[model samples]
Target: MNLGLKTAVAAFALTTMALTAASAETRVTYKSAKTGSSYYQMGVELAEAMKAGTDGDISVTVEESQGSVQNVMEVRARGGDYVFTTPPALVGLAQGGKAMFEGKGDPAFDEIRALFPIPSLTMHFVMSADSGVTDISGLAGKTILLGKGSFGATEGEKYLDLFGLTDQVEIADAELSNAVAALKNGQIDGFVTAGSYPAPNVIEAAASTPVTVLSMSDAQVAETKRTKLTIPAGTYAGQDSDIATTSLPVVAFTTTKMDDDTAYALTKTFWDNKAKLGDTSPWWNGVDPAMLSNIEGKIHPGAVRYYEEAGIALSDAQK
Candidate 1:
């Protein structure tokens, strides 16, 4: 072979190796919890599905974190390949909520997208029934602990923003576990948690202490509409007959960085295995595969591919 031709062939071989290695090494990080909560479990399920559906073209690793806020930061930093998060936190990150990233900075809204609209998250404000806190206003002058990051904060802020309760309530932030402990120890007058129905932590906290789960009033619900929200039915625990409550919408967010093929694969795998995931997590029972269309933020290209292939129409914005 000519000397120049030999060099060219060597270079081509090296480039091919590099590309193959990169493709084979594509890794996805999924953050959830170690305690095996339904949310975390669902994340694991999705990650596993993606890996399997892609036939090892992509590999996902599940890790535990402080839930949505941490997931958002990790994915934004490229530390996480994908994240499972609820809508309010996704919006809060977009709006730059305080104490986020330890004030490192706000989440870059443009870099993020919604993979799917998760089932509704019932915002739980647990107060002793005897505490005479029948309405949101009644919680005023009491020491309240909202879940850490923005889970609890969003609910309290939303309620306050909507009901003009800024001057009425005193709010503090606490991790979900700590907030539950605080309520049990009488260290806090009330504890707030926003999650899918029968949130294990809230249920455990409520069982330990007699408490009431406050529902959003009509006006408060209206304000929530200003943000992207969904209220699917059949998602609550003890939510029938005795303590019935309506649904609230929440979305599972992703980043814009996910490639079209990968995103489509993930979306397709999730929908295909929806029944199994729902059976494992009651919170997902009523999630209509059809509702994936309404998720907010920019739609991912992969998701677009998957939906289109599934015969679901896409908006121009999605394409």
Candidate 2:
């Protein structure tokens, strides 16, 4: 072969390599909640934060998820670049192979890792009428629909057990999607739901008919080992006073399949840019570094690296 021809072939190979390297971009799929929900909004914000934080080096694709259960279920079919959010307790149930995960356990759940807490899943025990029942105990002797297989359902039932209302309250087996209509029609006395406050369904229920947002006492909140939050009066139509409640902390999670570098970048971007996100969203304001204590599973190594560099204390689970 002529020397000139060999030099030309080498140049072509070098150019091809340069192009491949330049086009290399890390892509991640962030699945959280259904479209039009606050969680979905967070996903979008976080995606933007990731891109901006990395100067467009990393790209995130936000995908709508049905719910946490559906999000966790997809981990079995997802690859390393997949990330999702859920209440930390749900991850515990998944690991233990309990609740909806019963008889459906797989090695995939074991690979689940925590990223960071977004916000607490505040429980809203919305009643159809202003029954003057002040706290969770009011469920006694009332027919309540707690839904099924959701973080809300399990956590709500736990509250019922804690408050000793299990035997006293009649639990309906109806679908939660129709809970608002049922409440308006007087089909059930009330229902228990856990989500960010001012939940859309709760608002719709309050607007459609007379409603009450019951409050839990401080003692009840302490007993639940969850966070205390108050839904201030006027948050809903005709609501007259603040309602106390407990909330289950929620966290973003990923599988161990994600590489440490990508995990670190995602976590770092969130912490560095969260203040900017908070400027436009009230939910981001609720998150803090201390909430790391609430994450139940192993923290992703990449996120761990960021926390360590930032001098954030690691939770016992993470350490």
Which candidate number has the best TM-score? 2
Query: For model 2, how does the per-residue alpha-carbon lDDT over 1-319 read when each residue is reduced to its tens digit?
Result: 8999999999999999988876777899999998987789888998988889888878999998888889998999999999999888888898899999999898999999988889677888888764556567677888899999877899989988988888999998898888998888878999888777667778888899988888888888899898787777787899888888888788989999999998898888889888998776656866889889887679999999999999999977784
Q: What is the Cα-based TM-score of model 2?
A: 0.73
Q: Count clashes in each candidate, considering only residues at least 3 apart in sequence or on different chains.
A: 3, 0
Output the lDDT of residue 147, model 1: 61
Native-referenced Cα lDDT, model 1: 0.64
Ten-residue region with minimum lDDT total, candidate 2:
128-137
lDDT of 2 at 61: 98
TM-score of each: 0.64, 0.73
Q: How far is candidate 2 from the true structure (C-alpha RMSD, Å)?
A: 4.7
C-alpha lDDT values of all predictions? 0.64, 0.85
Residue 231 lDDT, candidate 2, scale 0-100? 74
